[model samples]
Target: MTIRFGLLAFPGVQQLDLTAPYEVFASMDDAEVHLVWKDTSPIVSATKLALQPTTTFAECPPLDVICVPGGVGVNTLLEDADVLSFVRKQAAQARFVTSVCTGSLVLGAAGLLKGKKATTHWNALDFLENFGAVATPGRVVRDGNLFTAGGVTAGIDFGLTIVAALRGREEAEAIQLSLEYAPEPPFHSGLPEKASVEVLGRTRQRLAGSRMARQAIIARLAAARHGAE
Candidate 1:
């Protein structure tokens, strides 16, 4: 049987976070990958790159996997009723629900991570607690059907891990070899604790404004959902 995969797209999505995983899944034998968006036309990335969606949320099939990727756009999606609703519904039916970076926040917004251990972009782990998730520090954490990965670049690792789970380690290793998945960062600032205090402060400052906005929206959504309950 052909495995069906869905990759969600929204405005402000990190280009690499979504594409890297796509390349992995697309390379798999007998897998059909669909870019599912809220729209039918095109979605623009945070970097202003344009991507066309093959399917809209309303038309997405019962998926074997649903991959949500993080980016600057997540701040806007925090309170988007339609997007959250689609995520909740599709994830409920999906065999595997996966997220990268702040994409976990969107899954949390969909009520998928409650009482579950999950991880997100290092800078955003505290926010996951706001949704009742136990913030983990691993590059990838798989809890039942929900698999989450940390930060932007971690998507590559997360995808490779899942590929091994689905197709076996040998197949995944062959693909990894073909892709030359080795990484050698010039600096040791990838993780939050590894970075210098000054560098962390500077990076936090750059994202502070957007983070605050997203936090506020997340709080409001949580409150609204609580009130309904």
Candidate 2:
């Protein structure tokens, strides 16, 4: 059986978030991985890497898995009706609904995260509560069919987790071995909890603009939702 995986590709997306999982899924035998977008036009990543969409929302076939990979682009997606609708429609039938980093926020925006335990980048963790989701802190968090991953590199681990769930432990392990997926960071400052106060502060400062923008968008969304109620 062919397992079809669709990963959302958008302008300003974090390339690694999409490509890391794409690598894992594409490596699987009989697995088809697609870079899906609104159109087939080329889009650039947050780091300025160019990516071409393999399929559009209208042309993409039914997928076994629909994954959203996040970055600065996700801020715009949170309020994009078309993107949210596509995700909602796909999530309804997809076997797995998944995300990386702030992509979980997009799922939340589409009303998929309410009361579900999910996780995102540590910087955006608290924002999940605004979407009525329990903000869990972890590299990978799974609640039933919804799977979410933490910042950036965590997508690799998330992909392996999903692979194990869909295929088998042995296959997942084989893929891991084939990719040599091992991590050895020279610094212990990956997480805010483990990082020195100065390092954490500097990192937060660098991310403050995007974080603040997301906060405003979430607040606006929450207010609109309450007004409708």
Candidate 3:
């Protein structure tokens, strides 16, 4: 049986968030992976890498898995009716609804994460509560059919987890072996808890601008929702 997977490809997306999973999904036998967008036009990533969409929201076939990968672009999607609608519509039928990094925020905005245990990038983890989700911490968190990953590099682990769930541990391990998925960072400071105070401060300072922008957007969304209620 063919497993169809769709990953949202949007402007300013973090390329690794999409591609890491794409590589894993593509390596599976009888698995079809798509880069989906509102249109087939080329979109650029946050790092300025160019990506072409294989299908549009309207043109894409029913997918077994629908994944959203996050980056600076996600703040815009939080308020984008079209994008939220597309995700909501797809999540209604997809076997697995998933996201990488702050993409979980998009799923939350679409009302899929309410009361569900989910996780996103550490910087954005606290924001999940605004969507009525229990903010869980992990490289990947799975609550029933919803799968979410942490920041950028965690997508690889998330993808392999999905593969194991769908195929088997052996197949997932084989894929991991093929990809040589091993972690060996020179610095042991991937997480806030692990980083030195100086390093963490610098990192947070660099991210403060985007973090503040996201906070404003979330606040606006919350106000709009409350007004609607």
Predicted model with the maximum lDDT: 3
lDDT of 2 by residue, 116-224 (tens): 9999999999999999999999999999999999999999999999999999999999999999988899888899999999999999999999999999999999999
Q: For residues 23-108, could you state the per-residue lDDT of candidate 3 as single tens digits?
A: 99999989999999999999999999999999999998989999999999998999999999999999999999999999999999
Go through the candidates in order and give the clash count of each: 0, 0, 0
What are the models' TM-scores?
0.96, 0.99, 0.99
TM-score (C-alpha) between model 2 and the true structure: 0.99
Q: Model 1 clash pairs? A: none
Kindly report which residue stretches of model 1 are placed more than 4 angstroms away from their true locations once superposed.
Answer: none
Residue-wise lDDT of candidate 1 within 71-154, one digit each (tens)? 999998878889889888888888899998899999988888999999998778889988889898899999999999998888
Candidate 3 colliding pairs: none
Higher-TM-score candidate among 1 and 3? 3
For model 2, what is the alpha-carbon lDDT of residue 15? 97
* Worst-scoring 10-residue span by lDDT in model 1: 217-226
The lDDT of each candidate is 0.89, 0.95, 0.96
**TM-score quality measure for candidate 1:** 0.96
